[model samples]
Target: MSKTVGVIGGGQLARMMIPAATNLGLTLRVLAEKEGEPAALAVTALGSHLDVEDVLRFAEGVDVVTFDHEHVPQAVLRELVARGVNVQPSPDALQFAQDKLLMRERLAELGVPVPDWARVVSSEQLARFLADHGGRAVLKTARGGYDGKGVRVVRDASDADDWFAAADGEALLVEELVEFRRELAQLVARRPSGELALWPVVESVQRDGVCAEVIAPAPHAAGKVADVAADIATTVAEALGVTGVLAVELFETTDDRLLVNELAMRPHNTGHWSIDGSTTSQFEQHLRAVLDLPLGATGCRDEWSVMVNVLGGPATGAVTDRYDLAFADQPTVKFHFYDKAPRPGRKIGHVTAGGDDLDLTVFSARAAAAFFDN
Candidate 1:
């Protein structure tokens, strides 16, 4: 029997899952906000994920419900569970991804290595934390923050006055500004029945708080770094009862210590390279994990896979307009574009190049992505 998986967002992540779902013979359905969404190819219903009626209506007849983004309201998720809908990575586990403050509190209890942080609701509290942490801190709204939004670097308490004023009486999360050598991301998938699979820890490059590039297997990360990253992800998965893909973003500090930075419960930007570089893509693995199917091997298809995102594409034409030049210049590179209108600082697509020669592979990806730059 074929199982139908319903995704709650119609973004590129959901769009990318369509081919994986087809290969696995699973039916893919999406609850999109409107027409022309990237996942419009698989959309079965058009409604707001925030609305109880819309989400409940989309849940009908699907074997399992998942998400493209974590912005879905907890009340809606719990309601789905209460009504007998199988929500993968249940609201209990999903909350850690949704609410940053709760995530910090729980990770601290679990003894997960994280940055020094505090919950502050006022400038006085923020001022004290700043004073303790060298007059500089990273302040973030506990919820609704992604891609650099709702996050601020404060040199003084007054820098966060606006966020505090708009926090809805909620304590925001503030942490010591971490000094790190580089950023790394670990991707893992766990089934409800306890089986788990992990991919190689990869290095991620962020430009203006958005992922711009990824290098698989994280150069020079064979022993302790890889082992620790995998351990951290496994511990979090088992403890939180997470099902489907979990991305743990980490900081490899200048002090040689790895610290947890952020968590995403679904397919993440860092793992996007696996779509063309691994034995099994994260999207395929996610479907398998959510359905309790046997997971696939995560071996690399190449020694080095470099993925560069196409950000802020051409100002006038669509992304496809540049394919003519890109395809000719980098034949070995794999290009993927989401059907989204170009805007400043938006991720419109990505190109991946994999080979034993890291330099050539990196160049191929960069050259291909450069074609799309405005």
Candidate 2:
């Protein structure tokens, strides 16, 4: 019987998984909150990812269950596991991805390097933290944060009042803002049978709290930095007992220290360039990891590949009509459009350009993204 893979969220990440699933002769199903969600355009099933009944029904016949996002409740995952559903990145391991504070604590316990942080629940606590950390720090909610949401930079006590009120006086984390030279991401995949694969580290550029572009194999990254990143990613995956793809976002501090920034247990935006640039795309590697299939080579197809996100602009309604013009002039630029309705700052789609020259590839990607700008 052909294997059936059930994905929990219907977004671009899941949408991209379709081609890989088809190539492997595996059936793909998606549990989405609404129709027209990215993966819903191609997935076999459409339902609410958060509804237990919907998820249970969707998983009835699947060989294994994975996810496009970590928003699913741990209780729901545990229940599914209780009923014999094979869920990759099991609930126990997924918790670290779901809650940043938990991930920080766990990583620290494992002797992983990370920025200094503390949990603060009150204005007084925030004040004390600020006093110790040069009166400037970053406050992040323990849950429900992404794309720069649920994060704040506060330099004074009054700035934390709203957070304390909104969280019902619950604890929040305040971390010292380190001066980082640049951000880098390390992608790794772990199989159920204990196999692991790490891809080349990529440099990520962020603008206004959103990822603007990704440059593969990080241009000036020392050989030792790449080796360290891969080792750290592998160690985290093994320590977390994760199955499927895991991405470790890092901070390259000004002093050359690498500090862990975030952990993602599914396909990440940072790895988007792999689709057109690597022999094995992250989507395919994720499927293979979840299915415990032998992993594939992660060799680069070109010396450089750059991915640029097309953030929604005022003329978003014209995206469909503009696709023709967008690609008509640049056939070498690969465009992956999510079937999502555009909203300001939303990730509508992305463009990837691959070539031997890094600067040329980045320029091509930027031009493609600019074509869609209103």
Candidate 3:
């Protein structure tokens, strides 16, 4: 019997991990919510992560259960562990990634630098936080939030009144609007045996709260910035007892301080460039970490690597339809497309370009991605 790895979500992360698992001779199984998800190739079960019975049935066949996303409920995860199923990045560690409020509390305990935050269940409490912090703040739901979803910026507390009403007394996490010069993400892999490795910190560019592009080893982040980013990721991985790839989204504040912005306990959008530019992609490293296997080297294959996401692919037909143009225009670029349908703001695919010249790499990556624009 082959070592089987079960993924709880059938999104693009799982889709990308399938090839890495196959290369290692492991059977990758995904419990997707429905048919036709991106990880359709490896989807062995059609089930919901929120349904305990569905997850339990899926986990019975795999050697270890991991995740493609952090949305799995704690009750379901805990049940798997109780039944003697091996779950990497156990529910205890994953809760921090699942709930922004809990994440803030735990990071605070770990002495991690983060934006000033408060848990507000009422409009009065939100207004007070607004007054204390600059009359404006970033509001977020404590759970089930990702990308640009469940997050908003508001100057008036009333702007979030509908959310408060919808919360049904559940507290929302509100943070002081950060003054960031740029966003950076540090990718780290940790195995259950306590070994850890980190990739160079990369700068992430955001458009409408969604990651648009990423530049590896963030330009000019050679000294203090890179060092600090790596240190933060290492600390969190160790303190939180996280196993598998951990992505620490950070804000390089205008004042030169690096603050934790968000956390992901799976392969993240920022680290997608590693598939083409690093000696070991995050997908491969994630599999190794969860299985407690030796980690691969994290060295860069080029001086610079730029990854640009293809958003809302071509208005008509599929992304494949425009590949002729993209491939011809940017021969040096490598493309990875999710077999997802085209929709506004949806991430259909991405292109990565690596070269000694940073400007050329960036231009090539962006050009390839633009061909898929709607």
Q: All candidates' TM-scores?
A: 0.99, 0.97, 0.99
Which digits, one per residue and each the tens of the lDDT, describe model 2 over residues 190-267? Answer: 998999998899999998878889999898885888988988899899999999999999999999988999899999
Where does model 2 exceed 4 Å of error?
313-317
RMSD of each: 0.7, 1.3, 0.8
Task: Name the runs in model 3 displaced over 4 angstroms.
Answer: none
Indicate the residue-level lDDT of 147 in model 3: 81
Which pairs clash in model 3? Answer: none
Question: What is the Å distance of residue 271 in model 1 from its true position?
Answer: 0.4
On residues 176-255, what C-alpha lDDT tens digit does candidate 1 reach at each position? 99999999999999999999999999999998899999999899999999999999999999998999999999999999
lDDT of each: 0.94, 0.90, 0.94
| Model 3 Cα lDDT, one tens digit per residue, 251-348 | 99999999999999999999999999999999999999999999999999999999999888889987788988888998889999999999999998
Tell me the TM-score of model 1.
Answer: 0.99
Off by over 4 Å in 1: none
